[model samples]
Target: EREWPLAYVPLLIDEKEWAEISAGLVQRADLFEAILADIYGPNRLIEKGILPAGLIAASPEYLRPIAGIRPASGHFLHMVAFELGRGPDGRWW
Candidate 1:
């Protein structure tokens, strides 16, 4: 059998801090969606030299076979998880 580790104590945050964090996360998600849409669709980032074609092509996560396929939900990413860590300065990175 496998067991999952759980935290007994919850980390608390003030409303203002939570709002800032939430906004940053939303912005990150939006950026990810835009990047994914571009790479799989028009690829304007690569075409405009904002991103190198070779770099994206070499990535393991880049799926060349499904480049032009559209998702039923009309979004490439339905959900995403981010691994966050606090820096030495006590700021979340």
Candidate 2:
């Protein structure tokens, strides 16, 4: 398997459990939004739960430093995997 992971959320959550679970989203969003705002003047949805931290971090392509700062725009996994070969330092970028 390339990767395996598990996540659990209360899509069918009860009213009493709703607030508690969602609370973490609020707190997490606050922290995330603050960081983004400081960087990009508030990224709207990225500040909301709609966009996730891992997604932004996992974005295979992006140039926040080279583009966001320097400009000219930017953006995926620029990685390569060998069929059955491997090397210690030739790891994926």
Best by TM-score: 1
Lowest-scoring 10 consecutive residues by lDDT in candidate 2?
A: 70-79
Candidate 1: Cα lDDT at 93:
76
Model 1: per-residue Cα lDDT over 1-93, one tens digit each: 325344568878789977888889989998999999999999999999999999999999899998988878889989988755566898877
The true-structure Cα RMSD of candidate 1 reads 4.3
lDDT of 2 by residue, 1-93 (tens): 344333345235567655764665566566654554443434455667677756766676533664234223321212223222124674211
What TM-score would candidate 1 get against the native? Answer: 0.78
Candidate 1: list runs displaced more than 4 Å: 1-8, 86-90
- Model 2 lDDT, full chain set: 0.47
- What are the clashing pairs of model 2? 60-76, 61-75, 61-76, 62-75
In the order shown, the candidates' Cα RMSDs to the true structure are: 4.3, 15.7
Error of 2 at 27 (Å): 1.2
Q: What's the TM-score of every candidate structure?
A: 0.78, 0.33
Candidate 1, residue 73: lDDT: 83
Candidate 1, number of clashes: 0
Off by over 4 Å in 2: 1-11, 41-93
